[model samples]
Target: MKKHWSVFLTTFMSLLLASPVAFAASPAPQVNAGDTAWVLISAALVFIMTPGLGFFYGGMVRSKNVLATIMHSFFIVGMISVEWIILGYSMAFGDDSAGLIPGVIGSLSKIGLAGTAGQIVSGTSIPELAFVIFQCMFAVITPALITGAFAERVRFKAYALFTLLWSIFIYNPMAHMVWGGGKLFALGALDFAGGLVIHILSGVSGLTLCLLIGKRRGYGKLPILPHHLPMTVLGAALLWFGWFGFNAGSALGANELAANAFVTTQAAAAMATVSWVVCEWLHNGKPTILGAASGCVAGLVAITPAAGFVAPIPAVIIGLVGGAICYFAVAVLKAKCGYDDSLDAFGVHGIGGTWGAIATGLWASTAVNPAGVNGLFYGNGGLLVAQIISIIVAYLLGGIGSFVLFKIVNAITTFRADEEEETSGIDIVEHGERAYSQSIMTGESLGLPNEFNKMN
Candidate 1:
């Protein structure tokens, strides 16, 4: 009896000693309240940007196509939201351990968010659901940004199909490559927010699509002016407000990195605004509100990739140069190239994103975020090379992927509206509605006047 008791006691002690190590090997994640709240709030902020973008683009288009233009952004919010829930999130962030082409895309292990419940993100204290929702907002807005390129000319059905396909093929793979431990991440390229993934991809794709879709009827023959500057200004304000979330939220925590990003975002935007207005004043002899709004956006785009890696001063220089370059692209390059990018999507986003990416390589510093490496000015040229390579890859993916998707969409249905439809108005032809009941200029009822008005 004593021998048996001794053996039992010894075995129990050994098991107890081994339990802690076993648990330590796969410890459960702990949630942080502060981090979770910040991420959720940031997600909400990004969600509003799509509608804000609608108003911005809608105000720039002719009055006859305003509703149709706005519809593009609004509808995408619904369409892409559903797509993300179903498969987008999985393809964008799922583990690639089982992928046949590892580092290019993700596996479908998390499809429909199957195993996400009660799970925490790998490096953060937030729940996996929080990350999914935040990224969903990004996926929703990217394709919507493309609408500005072919506004007032694309068939609604064709636009819908192209956006869905583009999200699946272009946006998903790119997101994985940059943020999901894929090829770009493995290659040590840094994109703090989305210079290569969002701005460059959408901008270049917009350029390709606009070229393929042809110009709006009378694009060069007639003057195409914005119908509502106030609305556009309001839209710009919303975008500016939301951008703090876009840049800072990328930090994934409410910490010093987030604070730094916030400061840099403001500094870059302000400097860009000043530089753009000054440049316009010098070149055109006057500064326009449109120029100010466009400049601010350019600066925002240019600073996105470097927000976390750079200091506030570097951000300002980036913005100053970015605003001027984008202005030139819109004002001079568009005119010289003779391509009708209806709203300068390529000019501001593509050009700004390219500059921002290269600037990241030029100005990035480990001092700002120890996770990141130094850039050219900080005594490292390899980062600059990486940035250039990423830029080239982005251009190729955006241009080639968009071309193929456009062709497929066009084959399924006529991509561009007919000449008669263009003249009559896409709002009425595509949506059977008008933005306004009466024309402010003529005081006349718009959109095929009612029988009583006709009789009058």
Candidate 2:
């Protein structure tokens, strides 16, 4: 009741402020110290998540492929960073892009950050440059997420090419449609952050790559254990830490909405962690640290879309749903489908993201944010319908788009490494390097032949 009153008062006040008299007296938008600082800091936090993801995924693959796995995420940071300022950012956020299909892509007007610099972002206090760098962090992580699916057997050069193309064709357009003032935004679909743009897109793309690239050699035939568990836990910690910025920062201001998002983000992540461990304990007789980590991430993904529009309790419910749903996706569904989705990227991020988006429609409240709509529980089912539509669109596009991108990339050059390279381990075969120095110490001690030691 209090929240309802608050929403009513806020709305009433907004109307009053928007009147003709208020418009003339209102101060011009200027740089806001707090919002700018928070957003920039949030960008930095998000930047750390890619390497953290590398550690999380790296720890899950076999020791021989750890370096290769880490390299995928680490290198995308540099690759996408360049791509962003070059043309990627323009394609994503450029205002003038009424694309070939209107709202599907941004204009190339801002290519190379051409005319966008220290100028203020429209309706925001931050400089255009700040928004560019902040969004670049998101672009970097999306492709890195796909690397987990095709981890060991992928040719690095081919993977690199795919990353370039995927960002251009798949990621950039999707980002534009949702957050870039594109069709979805125009249609009233509300994505506070990037449940559709990032998670769903990457998850579907990850699955597509797995099918196109084929499974890692000896996938189900042999148990491939994590080379290191502690690294994964550390990576999860970093991801959770970074997500506060990802969720809260999306508010684009250090205001009540940002505070709400911050609190909801933590609540969802914590609840999901508990729910995941509990779910695993009941089913498997013991809950592993991996379950806990996976659960937390699932929770984060689930709450992202709802962070600003729902209260803490709903966030907890979203997390619980995410935890259980993702567990089933990875454990039961993956086995039945026979796809080796290494690290369960499709299960965790994809499923969690979809659920989170729908949950937004179920739990969102005008009371929490008048700028947002009420959800089904709050007496509107229309938002839920839009959420479903966005989910379907994302899956279809990500799947079909990834397939085409793979065909194009493969026709140009082979995407998969040869059998000999796979057998020898990708780190040594492709990079001429090892993840651990201990391999070197043990190599000479074992008295292996010089040719064998070459790892090729």
Candidate 3:
């Protein structure tokens, strides 16, 4: 009996030793340093997009709330960064214990990313830290995008609480469903860069929040002209540059897939920008640079879901459709619907995301992405049906979840600044600072009458 046991143990050890050699004999993955470096840079580039968002949102609002709007984007970088490190990553990516929520809150208990360096997840050569950092950038920008809808009115305290709650309840769960080992990923939903999970969800949440908060006082009556159109333009340029990373980096490797995503992103943005401008020129009698930029962003948002799955032509079509649809949504639906999306977050991101998701179902093809499914145009109508379901589910869930969370937050602290404080402007009243202090000081220093103060 002892001899038989020894023989079995010896055979098991021999098999284990031989298996690795057999596997090594198969084709090995070519680890390209240039590709790795490019992806790393791309990840950092995406992280830069949050600040670009801050500037874009900052310049679009009246100067009164410029800093306040920027702060919301800035705060997202800090708030969600910590959340991602603590519970967020675990909830999304950890072992699927119950096949629902990720098994343990402390599954990633090694806080401060202890021992994360040099660690490798199976099937990939990249360090686990690289994946963590890449995903962290996604978490940072998503809530920042929502700030556009509630730009001028929401109190800082309420804003902070809402973002915290959102990171926990909305962003984390949707991320798990769409990207992590959850039912949605299991069901074969294709989201290359978070069109449904981030853009649509945040867009719906933004719309709901703005509705609940009501319009800014004297919204229609007030001119509320953007204080710095040039700044907004520059910000848009930055967004365009940053988006290459946002879409391409999702491929996680600098391979043909990444190159395809890059081209698709550019084509979509260009087509959408042109389509939006043409539509606006026809309807509004002229196309403003603001409209052009907005159209580009709408296209970017729309193409995000289909970036990896669709070819360049379909990407362009998707962008054009997104631009046309989002333009109308911002121009027509907003006023008639009586929702005051302060910076058009709902009109652009929400509507664009919905269109993009549907477009993915329409344009997806196995030629560009073998792992992805073919869409309706490729004779797969079921994919389109699934996309529609995804859209409805995302909007309803995100809208309701955000509303409830805001209510809870509002109950704890006043959600809006008092009328007196709001009238005074958040920079002075809330932050005890002004955005153009130097300009104000210079104006005061000059004996001549201050045109800026008079304009204000």
Candidate 4:
């Protein structure tokens, strides 16, 4: 493990420090105004999911850490945006390399976006800039998704560092393999959006961290109720709204495929929401807002890989199963297993994403988008097998890579909040601010903006 870590660090450092002069810059391609406009809109929409994710996770944690919990997602947006600009974009989407490792991990020839502005991505009308910005939104959300696993117990500094390193180590490689035309691309693996890349990588990382960090100070004994379900519901709505852009934008064109992805996204989410509510009602004898919200997100995650390959009918099946399976994972599996995933990141995203990728194998149809292949149901078992291979590769790489990085980050930074801070609350102690206050109306001890404030 140590040797492997050293090797990975050495390789990553080389890419990090590589000069941008290695590869000859290609002339800029003519970008379609309509495609550029659509991609821009999609990128903006996907970016909003981070805040929505913040609200969703925030509402699930104790009120004392509301601001801190929300801040994880909020802060990562700015932090990973910078990291992406630094070397992430280049490492994931740079020109193809002859080196075996570089093919799997991308070359740094395009590092720092040097010589990439007006260039058009090969075979697409969208500007390379639009593609870069769109992919940046993905990098931003992947680490934020992991925050759910260790919420209320993580040091903000450590989490931020993990985001930076994880983007380089785990997230970037997966992005390259699946979408950046790396090894998996050569193997004919399909991830129309990010079933294997974003959701699975984040999910595996979340589960690993939950196990490594152990349960929160209080395990199953404490009742960590959600502070606000409405906020979570609203967040769910925003994720649904943003996901259309996430799925359709993968088409990278303003064409029929994008239209199909748009409708399928809506169909899957709607059905999944309904199915989740129904499943919860059957299991617990009452349907909760949280269940419905989770189901909606689960459906979105599951359909993501197949959005362009499957029609509305198949999408409905995918969403329904996604909701039911995720419900089981969250409601039954997590409790039975006794791991405290504070916000069910692994349950919904990890499980849903894995299933979605497999389902794409079963339901993918070349008819929906000619660029894609037919699935098992559509007379091709090969695509399904390819999807499974991609899933396995993603699981091993994402899970193991994340575990090593977490240990390293912990060794250096201690990674988690101290017991006292975790108990007292991160919002007040870590951020020096409260989510709620009474300064204008009642000034006293714990008054105004500071927890240290005292009336004289």
Candidate 5:
């Protein structure tokens, strides 16, 4: 009996000692000021991407509506900011009130961002406020992205209303479903950034609005190449810089994973650019700088969903495919579909996002990130299946949701301006400003709407 008791005691002591060692060897919970600071800076970086998007879209539009186009993004930033703080964050991340949608609309009250400081997120040491600010940038840009669809037309009054409603109904719910500690987040779906919530949703919604609003004045008759490629290139450069924050910031830290995400983001963007140039050169006999810029953006969108999951090598593969696929999607598919996307938002963001979702399922390896599941390449078929389901659900829901919302807006306000208003230019007719008064101007000022400014 004495010998047996001694043996049991020794085993218990050994188990106690080994347990802590095992836990220590697991993913470290260590935190430092540097990582936290990097995340805060990263949050700011993502915020700048919206203005960059504004400039890129503004430059491609006709000179008549340059300022108006830029205003679309700018106004969205302001409008969404107020809405996000008031109701958007609660709808997304507020506690699961009923387990139905998680967070009641009125539970957190309007603009009541109290008790958010010093509160840690479930898995990390970063404060909840850090996550809130990081996510606010996403809410700011998603709706702004849709402005490209109805560019050169649409009344600003109706546009503002549409932007507000869309953010509340569409963007917020999707963000909650995907990342707000809800059903989709628990379903093993992989979306490191806003590929589904931001890019895919915006792209599909833009396509829907364009379809409902009808084509622009010229339709298929006139050539409308970019008004200023140089401006577009500059905008693209800004987006490239801002994307490091967009992708890496999703990690919410300045650790090895953030570094990995940063490197992968750069590698994919480079590879996608090259792939686009090659494909364009082969098909059109020469690659333009415009194509290079488009390719870079396409690569950036494609890699967003997979940035934190896959390793560097697969990221390169994803980029190469992204360039080739998005080029065909824009140049060939849009032409065949006859849908006036106006800016290829669907082609680049939608198609590229789909590719990234699938590639993530194929390339994710647990060796690099044990917290994340391994993909098919790493002998896990279940994760690949889950990824496919996520893509299907996101596309169907986003596409159908936008269509319904646009239909309702169409019933209330005329989606398109009259023919004369469209032809004369939306900037002068809708807004009391002309983007270029020197080149072509009537005797009257834009706001007066006198006989000289009247449409012929």
Candidate 6:
């Protein structure tokens, strides 16, 4: 009996000693519950921004086209959400070594979220799944941002097709370059959140598409005013609320960096709001609610790149300058260029994001985030150079890629609505639905002449 017990103990010890060697190649992931919770919650917050964007763009279009405009955002939420799960995530985040174009995009190893059950995100204590969903929200919102540029006049089928392709070809590649260890990441560019990845790419692509799609009917000849100011204000509020999650969540941990991002985001937004109102009041003789909302959004866009790398004081300056510059872009540059960017997507986001990226190079400091390097103000001009190069790269990718996609989608389906469809309203023409039933009963749904329909 004693000899048998000794044999059992010896066997158990041998198996335990051999287990480490067998599993040495792949260590277990260490996930922090708090970090995982924060990332997931932040992802949910970002998800709200898409529908919030729908309301924002929806309120700015003519009543007849309200539902169609909102549908652009709503449908993208569904389409891109599915695309992310299937291929977008893999293309943006899979192993670069196995990628179709190494260092330019990710491989398909993570297709359908395979091999992600217990993996931890690199450099973080959260599950890879959490990171995946967070990035998915970003993918969903980016193309939705473009709809505002060509509001009220695009064909639904063309928009759908264009969005899907853009996500795969344009968005995925750019995201990989900036955040997924691609070219820009290797070049030492610093985009704390998504100045280059999300805002610049989306804004530039919006400009390109709007140019290709041409202006809305009677764009220069007639007035095109927002139908609901209150709704626009509401949407703006939601965007501001969600932005905290957008910027702070990039830290990927519940730590000091997240707190710094939160503070800077508020500071920049408030200062930009004040600056925009002041500028508008001086230029136009009265401060408008639209200007205030737009200013706040501009500030948000500008601070996004610098949120985790700069101090609050620098953030305020970034917002102030961003608000003023974006206002000029929307009020002066677009008017001078004579190209219709329907809701000022290019003016606000394009210009704001540009300024934000530059500001990051000017004000970034390692004191704020040890992982980040110093910027120009901190005696490192190389960071600024890297930022500029990244900006130029983003512009080329967004502009050229979007132009090609626009032509492709247009060939497959007519991209623009006909004159009759434009005159009657795209909502009924495209979706066979109206936003407000009262308009249908009152014959207002036909977009007949009304007090609000004054010509420009």
Best by lDDT: 6
Comparing 2 with 4 on TM-score, the higher-scoring candidate is 2
TM-score of each: 0.93, 0.90, 0.89, 0.89, 0.87, 0.92
What lDDT tens digits, residue by residue, belong to model 3 across residues 354-407?
A: 999989998999999898999999999988887888788789878999989988
Candidate 5 regions exceeding 4 Å error are 1-32, 97-111, 440-456
Model with the higher TM-score, candidate 1 or 2: 1
Candidate lDDT values, in order: 0.89, 0.88, 0.83, 0.87, 0.80, 0.90
Stretches of candidate 3 exceeding 4 Å from the true structure? 1-32, 98-115, 437-456
Model 3 TM-score? Answer: 0.89
**Global CA lDDT of candidate 2, please?**
0.88
Off by over 4 Å in 2: 1-26, 96-100, 438-456
Q: For model 6, how does the per-residue alpha-carbon lDDT over 10-77 read when each residue is reduced to its tens digit?
A: 99999999999988867666899999999898899889998998888888988888899889999999
Leading candidate by TM-score = 1
Looking at model 2, how many pairs of residues clash? Answer: 1
lDDT over C-alpha atoms for residue 162 of model 1? 95
Cα displacement (Å) at residue 85, model 6: 0.7
lDDT of 2 at 29: 69
A best-first ranking of the candidates according to their lDDT comes to 6, 1, 2, 4, 3, 5
Q: Candidate 2, residues 1-456: lDDT per residue as tens digits?
A: 999999999999989877978667968668888888989998998999999999999888777788999999999999999998899988988883455456888888888899886588887888878788889999999889888888888888899999999998889989998888888877677789889999999999999989888887767765567778899999999999999989999888789999999999999999999988998898889999999999999999999889999999999888888899988898889999999888888998889999999998899998988889999998999999988898998999899999998999899999999888986789988899987775553244578665434331
**Candidate 4, 1-456: lDDT as tens digits:** 999999999999888767454455665577799998999999999999999999999888877788999999999899899989988988888755743376577778777899897788888998888999999999998889989988888888888888889998889878988888898888888899999999988998899999998888765654567877899998899999999989999999899999999999999898999999999999999988998899999999999999999999999999999999999999999989999998999999999999999999999888898888999998999998999999999889878988899888898888877777887778877899877653432224334443222110
lDDT of 1 at 187: 82
Model 4 spans with C-alpha error above 4 angstroms: 1-29, 98-100, 438-456
Query: Could you give me the TM-score of model 4 versus the true structure?
Result: 0.89
